[model samples]
Target: MLQHWLLGSLALQNIGRRKARASLLIAAVAISSAIVFTGVVMMRSIETSMAVGFSRLGADLMVVPQNALTNITAALLTAEPTGEVLDADLLDQAHITGISRAAPQRVFRTEQSEFGGQGESVDLIGYDPGNDFTIQPWINERLGRPMQPGDVILGAARDVPLGSEIALFGKPFRVYAKLGRTGAGTHERGIFMPSAELLALVPAIREQTRKTPPMLEPRKVSGFLIELTPGATELQVRFALLSHLSGTKVVAGGSLLTGIRQGVTALLGGAISLVSMMFASTALMVSVLFSAIVTERRSELGLLKAIGAKRSQIVGMVLIEAIVATGGGGLCGVVFGMLLLRLFERSLVYYLTEIGVPFLWLDRMDTVLVAAACILGAGLIGAIGALTPAWRSSRHDPYDLIRGEG
Candidate 1:
């Protein structure tokens, strides 16, 4: 251990003696590491943000009554409540393949006794809280517990405050949560409740309207929101649904964002290719630079070997020098990368969030791990770069090395 420490000290001193050359090597490594670190973090963060955003978009496909009126172009996130109804047990009866989860939604459109002004239609959507994927995921703010019977979630455009009582169809309901702005017609102006609660409210709705509502029929729902299993293509799932169920039309939810998702995937591939090339070039530069460094210090190494130094000792000294320089550079690069990410958050990320686009950064622990990996990778790269030249120089005759002829 003592001999190793002494060798390390000698290696550090040699680095100090050639300050300009050492600085050049460190700056080069720092540039490469900074690019690599920033690219990887940004790519991972963007991918995660995209996943969360798309998942919150409700379902991959929506199944509605065959004759139900729908604007295929506009129904991306949450489809507007269509009056046509389908059997709630439709999916169960069909036993459709590729279906991971199917959440039923019941809609009751009324303009009486309540939340909206006189004659202004309001849509009340009933969802199974346990089976819901769409409505609850967008809840930006809510009370501290799960939504219960007699509780309601309001749309973004609703002025009702949380925990406040609001009457809908002559029945009082507690405001449980509020959804974020989803830029959809129905989602921005609808009310959501559990299916059981909505089912129980059917009598009150019938009393208020003084007539029967077709959508409130027993075991009926406005639509079925379908989530597909992994490796299931939307087209394939649609075909299966059409084959099994005769009176339904499938609306693809991801159709609008498919191009954006593809573009993001292409950008990720480009970023990885760029980083790989940068690392390759950096390794080549390190090898060439170390070879020159060994050539310049031939006589000094020869004298050390002539006295008592073993080849292992010589190699260890050279490796220590390379590791220290590259590792220090990697540390500095990480700091610079952090600053870059901060700027990115303040600028582009802030703007996107303001425009309602989701953006999530890597967690602190993950950032630390990536930084540590970069430092270790830099040190390993240095050692590999210096190994060949250092070993070859050590194997030459001491007299030949001293004469600078080998």
Candidate 2:
């Protein structure tokens, strides 16, 4: 134990003695590890974001009026307004072969002058809270209460305060809660209210628009959101719905996101490839750096050998030095990477949204695992880099090394 302690002390002293070179090695490892760590975390986040986004969308299939298919798709995916309506009774068709759940929804446009200093037109989604699976999970988690008649929930992008009142069709509705950010989807720019409330407001809406025809009808809705039973494929449910319901079009939600998923997958694949190349180059650089360090310390190693030190002891000492440098670098790299991710999270999300990609932060366990992998991989790389140099140095003839003859 004493001998091991002394050797460790000597290794640490050598690192201190060569501060400049040690710092360079440490910095190189840190930069490489940071890149790898960031890439891993971001890739995982993108994947999770896509999954959660799909879940939040709350449907395996959507049933819309035959002529309004494209318009409804645009409304749900891009937050555009749709003025189309379908028979509310169409929701009954969801009880077909493979369907698990279905909820009716009515979407329309409403303008509020009190929001953001100027009048802004926002998409309003009226849903059946009792039968809803989509958006309800988030609402339950965030608000812990069911939505009531005159209450509204704002999407993450809208600048609204909870408990504040906003007029819709000349009636005041209190803001219930604000949702967390979900980028570039209908939820980001939507305000959700009870379908019953929206139905009640139709008369008032007609009163306000005396010269124009009413857009909303008492017993009509815009679409039906559907979920499939376990072991049931979307294709099966969609086909069944199509055959059962006339004047309606059923679309698989997965088909809507296929293009976005392909783009994100390509981006993640390229990033991983780049990170792998960077790690390889970093390992090579570490090997070269340790080789030079071993050459410089030839005399010191020789003296240790002269004092009856075994070759294994000499290798252990070099291994310790390499671990100290690389481990420290890896830790710093993790911190740096996390800081960068946090600082640029919003900007990164915005840019990806513009490019039609989904971005989200990883869960705690995933983040920790990614960080641990980066640090451990870096340490292993450093140890491997020192192996050849340590072996070669330990095998040198003590007398020749002492005489500076090799």
Candidate 3:
């Protein structure tokens, strides 16, 4: 134990003696690790953000009347005010397998009624409040009370305050909540209310417009947005829907977005490969530097061996110096990487969110774990790099090393 303590002390002293060179090695390792850490965190964050955005969208599959005119973008966000109608009882009768929850929507345009303003359009979306999964998820602020009849939830663009009253088709309704900006046209500019309330207003809306859309008919709906059960693939659910619900077309966004997910995954794989290559290069650099260090200290090592230092002790001392320097660099790299991420957040991520783009950072625990792994990896790299050179120098004859002949 005493001998080991003395050797450790001597190893630390050797590092102190060559502060300039040691600093250079530490700096090199720090820069490499910092780049790797930052790239991984950002890539993981982007993938996570995409997943969140998809979940909050509330539907993996959208079912509409066969031959009904539809917009692909609207299916991904909120269904547009298509006048096409379907039997509201279809969902109950279908009994499709793999369906966890399905919410019905009745969409109507108030362009003729001039609801918001003259020549301006407002989409009135009637949803089953009990079964709804989409609109509520994006709500930024709302009244604390449960949503009741005669209550209306406005999109993010509407300049309305909660608890205020607004007249729809000449009847007064209370403003219930405002949704967060979703960058979707319907979600940002639509008005949402319960199906029962919207149905009750059909008479008043007909009186104002002199015509009722097909979707406004009794026991009719524009479409149904569906959520699948766990372990159920989109294709499986889609086939089930087609088998049961006749005269309906299923729009599966998962199929459309699969390519995007693959692209992001590919990018992440490439980033990992690049980081691995950089670390490998850093390990090689450490090996060359330590080899030179062992060569230059030949006489010193011979003197220690002549005084009864074991071969293992000589190798351990060299390895200890390498580990300390590389581990310290790894810690500094994590700190610098965090600062870089902060700057990235303030500049790019903030701008994206302001423009209503979705982006979420990795959680704190995962980030810390990644940092720890980087530090451990650096230490292992140090040990591997110093091993061969240290062993080679320790095997030489003491007399030859002292005479500067080997």
Candidate 4:
């Protein structure tokens, strides 16, 4: 242990002597370590964000009419989907299944919305107040009260605040409450109302047909949301719903979360790999530079041998010098890497949130990993850099040094 300690101290001294070269080698390893750490965290954070986003569906088993899966997926993923009408009775049957709570929600759109600072076309969804709040805890009352007819909730609403009046079609809607930021959602840019009020916006189908080509079918409730009972497996419930409720899809809440995580992981992995490769190439360069330095120091090494330093001790000293240089560079790299990750998160928060993905701040585990990789990498580079020099010097004889004098 004492021998190793001496060797390490020597390494530090050598690195301190040539600070610039040491710094560059450390930079190479530190950068690589940071890339690995950032990639792992990004993959994890995005996956969690995606799962949360999918669960926003408000229903465990969405009982849309046949062929409406794409529409529902659209609403969940992009907040864009054409409206569909499905039988409302399906909600009751799902509830009676005794395995969970089922609530139905109706979705539609107003021809124009006052949400956009000015009137613009906007989508709207109406839900049963009692059950709706369970899934969307984020929908808590921020101002006037929980949702009611003509009461709409807004997202951060960009620069727009709550308490604004919105006009939808010919009806005046009040933005009585504002919703907490839910990353991104269909409702982020939409209005909410009682289904009855939304239905009132459209004339009776027969009445409309008389005037035009019956632009739309008589509107029915759009879908149902089911909450599984405790211990209920989401996958089992999903498939069970399919067996009973023909022509509808039961999307597993878990699967939705998994897909999002995997997608983000794939993206992050590719990017991180590319960045790591850059650092890796830098490390290779450091190795070559150090190797060349070791070669040039051969005479000095021979002189040390002539003074009676053992080959093992000489090798240990060379390694110590290389380690000090690399470790210092690595430590600096770690500090820079954290800053880079934070800067990246800040710059891409909006874009990541848009797709129900999040760029999480680096966590403790991430930091540990980054540091470990850098330290290990630095040690590796230094040791490898010293190998050839140590081997060459170990073979030197006192005769060679004496011969030089002759």
Each candidate: RMSD to true structure?
Answer: 6.3, 10.7, 9.2, 13.4
RMSD of 1: 6.3
Model 1, runs deviating above 4 Å: 52-61, 64-75, 78-137, 142-177, 183-247, 253-256, 295-299, 350-358, 391-406
Q: Rate the local accuracy (lDDT) of all candidates.
A: 0.83, 0.74, 0.83, 0.58
For candidate 4, lDDT tens digit of each residue in 1-406? 9878876786677677777766666666666555645565565565555444444544444455565544334223221234545666765565445245565666555443444545455566665666563235445355645555676655544334566766565467777665555455565655655556665656532253243111122335666666665445566666677777766655434445434434554666677678667656756776677667666666666776777778888788887777666666666666766676677776787667677553444467766875677667766766776677566656767466334421
Tens-digit lDDT string for candidate 1 (1-406): 9989999999899889999999989988888888888878888898778767755766878989988877654334454477788998999999878787788888777778477687888988888777777787788899999777889999999988999999887789999999888777788788988888888888888888777566667788888887776556788889999998998888887654544554566778888998989988888888888889888989999999999899999889988988888888888788888889989999999999999788989888887888898888888888888989999999988888899956
Give the per-residue lDDT digits (tens) of candidate 2, residues 1-406. Answer: 9878988898889899989988888888888888888888887787678655655654667887776735333223321246666778775644587666677777776654234445677677777877776665444224456556788887888776777788776788888877666564567778787877777777776676553222357677777777665556667777888888888877666654434544565677788888999999988988888888888888888889899999999999998888888877888899889987876685877787889665667888989998998888888888999989989888889876676534
Clashing pairs in 2: none
**Which residue runs of candidate 3 sit more than 4 Å off their true CA positions?**
54-73, 77-261, 403-406
**All candidates in order of lDDT, best leading:** 1, 3, 2, 4
Using Cα atoms with residue i matched to residue i, what is each candidate's TM-score against the true structure?
0.66, 0.53, 0.57, 0.46
The model with the greater TM-score, 2 or 3, is 3
Q: lDDT by residue for model 3 over 366-391, one digit each (tens)? A: 99998998888887788899999899
Model 4 lDDT, full chain set? 0.58
Show the colliding residue pairs in model 1.
none
Q: Which structure among the candidates has the greatest TM-score?
A: 1
- Using alpha carbons, what is the TM-score of model 3? 0.57
